[model samples]
Target: MIKSVIGLFLPVILALPLAAQEDSDVLFTVSGEPVTVGEFRYIYSKTNGQDADFSRASVMEYLDLYERFKLKVARAREMGLDTVVALQNELEGYRQQLADNYLLDKEVTDKLVSELYRRKQEDVDFSHILVSLPSLIPADTLAAYERAMDIRDGLTAGNFADRAAEVSDDAYSKNDGGHIGYVNAPLPGGMYRLEEAIYEAADGEVVGPVRTPAGYHLVLKHGSRPAYGEVEIAHILLRKSPEADPDMQKQRAEEARAALRNGESFEDVAAEYSEDDKTSRQGGYIGFFGINRYNKTFEEAAFGLSEDGEISEVIESPVGFHILKRISHRGIQPEAEQAPLLEAAVRQDTRFAEARKALFDRLEREYGTRKVDANYTSFVNGLDSTFFQLSTDLSAADRDATILEIGDQQYTTGDFVDYLEANARLRSSLERRFEVEGAAESLFDNWTDQQVERYAEAQLEEQFPEFKALMREYREGILLFEATKLEVWDRAGEDTTGLEAFFDAHRDQYRFPPRARVLKYTVNTAEGTDAQAVAQAAEKNTSAELIEEFGTDGLRIEEQVYEEATLPKGVTFKADTRSSVDQVDRNSAVFYRVVEMLPARQKELSEARGYVIADYQDQLERQWVEALRKKFAVKRNERVLAKLIES
Candidate 1:
């Protein structure tokens, strides 16, 4: 089934020369429409990948399938299913999803990845005193900058952490004296801009008043060192059960330790005694992990072991008692190999905002971006305190006022207002948290990014021909799905009268095999010699009375309907016959009675509706396809077909 479908719907492959061919280089034709070599090859390539069954299919075999497929698609087009509004909307949605894969600025991403890799080589330890400022409010930003500068001025040697604890707005590290421990570039927790600022400062020197989206910072670069990599470890745990004595946990751990000391295998000991169900089954292997993955105590102990097979003494954590063993440790990987990891980390990090801004800045310069300086200031002046509260609207004049010029395009105050309205909730939050002017400025840049991205996406077809080909294939696929539904699936499901007629015409194709109805009785005897009791139970006058007598002392009875071929082994009975057998166990006996017998018969229409409907649809589709084949003229190029096979 899978092979046949693959033969019919191959995907577009850029490397296939046939997919790039002109329409005049036709592979086949249906009716008056030509099926170009490109179309045929694109479909074929989808089913001709390294592991595809169609990779071994003959050109002629696939051509026959493709011809039928085209006939159906052509009929669908004639029926105008492609013009359906719902289908068009669905296709457009798919196009949007596909666009994401092609719309990114790859050049910028690659450059950032490479840049991050170079930075990842060295780890920097830094401290900072942050005075939070809103980006939009120039006044608040200025105040924050002054505060950072004053703090920088007062920073005596060895006093930066103390000042940071007292003054920094970063609650996470403020209480810890603002110490941001050894951050690698792209900044592990994504302080890329701060990392960059740290690199600019000499070791042990105080620097900046540097501005970030978060605030203005006074940085203290303590030192730098070669980057350290991750570690792999395993542990055997002895959990203290809530109702159990703590000493029992300690005793189990000691037993495990004694096993190891006595030269028993660590994996064997862990398998036998570790209380942690998850890792115990895997020989207590805890896999490779980086920093911050486990509790501080566990992490410290795991990393402390310097060599493989080295073990730590039994240690206790909040969860349980554990003994640790180092499996392996690795140093920093080569930058080239680490680029993808850094890129992924950066994308997920808020620090990517800085990199994104850098990209936008470059775009602005390339596109000759210009702000109408007077118009911007005038716009800001017109805004009142309620402006960010969603209580103000742009005046008619302000709506038309040009705020920015990029390349040959002009953006108005109206454009930015629309963006704000579209993201009203986010804008409201930012408004309450930060200064308004700086927020507006950042929003303007974001609006520009949308335009830039749209422009870039529009150029993709021209910039990359392969992307165009791929999209074309998806477009056809979307159309094909809608067309098939209308022509075959929906029609089959809704045509109840037609289905009944089809099923009636094919009644002889459905049947049932021989079957039987029987009762199986099991009786357990207290005396171990009660086969006579089972026989007497089968001979009872009333089922209820017989059950009351036999259904005691582990006795039970069950009735079932079954086909003759599916009846249980070693148990057989003729109609109206009853028999008993002594059990394999001395205390039990078995007996059965055939209640009735059923002969094979044809299944009713209602009984076979599900299977019949599908088969009927297949019959209808086949007839329709045959009619289409006769109406349309098909021509194949044998010479070109042979070339396809060779390729």
Candidate 2:
């Protein structure tokens, strides 16, 4: 197990660089390797927080500790621990973990999230004419795109609805002049592009030929309004009937409202007059509802109630009269409060994928990446029917052929094969349905995307200075942990002779305070046993002897040692004396008999092994650090140090 020495070293590895410094900014050197002022300042500021006042004493104290840390890291490098395969792999793993967050275009993601938040404040009323593609094959897609363009070229404010009704594939809205009602931001997954197009267009503006996963869409904006976020309402309903006049229902609703005005609780009025059996039991609660979930009349009346517990005037929808009481209303919150939700929504939506694709495309172009068409085709053609079963023998295949070139790195055919092997189940499934050529193409595209992403991740250290600094900190932390384990911790524990010697020297420091060895006895009075007899026997006999004599039937005895402070309250310590038996309850009695009272004494090495080993490790670390200081030459720039103190 790797015990962390990063915390022990304190301020050295705590913080990443705030900004890069020049060669002249070197604060000190350990074995000729410069430690920069910027690096020192960042770690010192972060570690001390408000106490980092740059006073001479504080700065010098931290600087001394940081210098020791650097010397240890230098020794680790000299030992060639950095070149060890396991440590190299661990460092790379950490780099990859950090890269995931740095790989995305934060500017683009933030803009998308902000736009979604702004659009969430209002609902857009729009209609779309979908030119449905029969399949996503190139021919079908091109035909759909062309047909959508032709329809868009002829579209205007007057004929859009008519054209949509004639040719649009959406059966739900085609017959209704293509109006799908008012929609808002975060329009379900796979429709983000459509949502963006509609929200971005002006009223009566014809937009799109915008392609979504569904098909191409020609959208017409029909204006927007402040969003009806959601409403929690309880309603009292009066259903219309064939036998009763509609006016009678309205009259009854008016009477119910009058009863509410006359100080009858809404729940009581609803239970008495509400016809909705499902909700009358719940005081006619419909819970919270957003726009378009309920009918226009019910939604408008419910949302129209401005204050909590305010009742609406009687509203009549297709079912009958509804009197709504608003429980609560939730509108759009401010951007800072809403950004997290909007960001989550954006990520779940397809737009996040689109943004990542844009990033990958930019990276590929910047790096001048190219696909080796001949090499890829050759590899794909070499696959046999066994490839579908993931049993193809690729050992004899030309593994060295370069399939892709990104910057100066060439990804070989063997690399692609390895990726395929890793995704064996997915590849086999794809091949079973689409066959080798099709599966090969799909997997190759995915592999290419991963390669591009990896390349971009590799560039992060060069592109972002803070990323480099962070990697350095983690690498050093790992090195320090391993170095300390080998130099201090393992030695302290394994060096039994050295541990005993150290313990002998510090024997007086490790001592047990005055303590009493006592035996507690309990007898269950319900068992009709003599409690006084049990206590008397416990004072002279071991627990095993008492258990044998009493046959272990509710006669219990336990021995323990307690120090003066830890002894039970109201109990006095006395050697060779038994306390008076006290009845614990109707069923039990308890008493303590002290066997022996011992004075303060030194602890054995075995008794204090843990504490002794810890102290020994600290001693070993200090000696090792002193040895390292001698082995490595440390030179400090006093001018920079004095300047830091003044600042």
Best-fitting candidate, scored by lDDT: 2
Q: Stretches of candidate 2 above 4 Å error?
A: 1-24, 41-64, 93-184, 199-206, 220-348, 377-399, 414-439, 495-501, 504-508, 514-551, 563-602, 635-647
Off by over 4 Å in 1: 1-49, 53-63, 97-187, 191-231, 234-261, 264-287, 290-324, 327-344, 358-381, 398-412, 424-437, 454-474, 493-501, 518-561, 564-594, 632-640
RMSD of each: 11.1, 8.9
Tens digit of per-residue lDDT, candidate 2, span 353-470? 8888787788889998898999988988888778867665654278999999999999999999898888888887885468778888888878888998888788887787678778
Cα miss at 461, model 1 (Å)? 5.4
Return the clash pairs for model 1, or none: 10-43, 11-46, 135-438, 136-437, 136-438, 136-439, 137-435
The residue pairs that clash in candidate 2, if any, are none
* TM-score, per-candidate, Cα-based: 0.59, 0.73
CA-lDDT, candidates in order: 0.75, 0.86
- The clash count for each model shown is 7, 0
Q: Which candidate should be chosen as best, given TM-score against the real structure?
A: 2
Write down the worst ten-residue block by lDDT for model 1.
Answer: 50-59
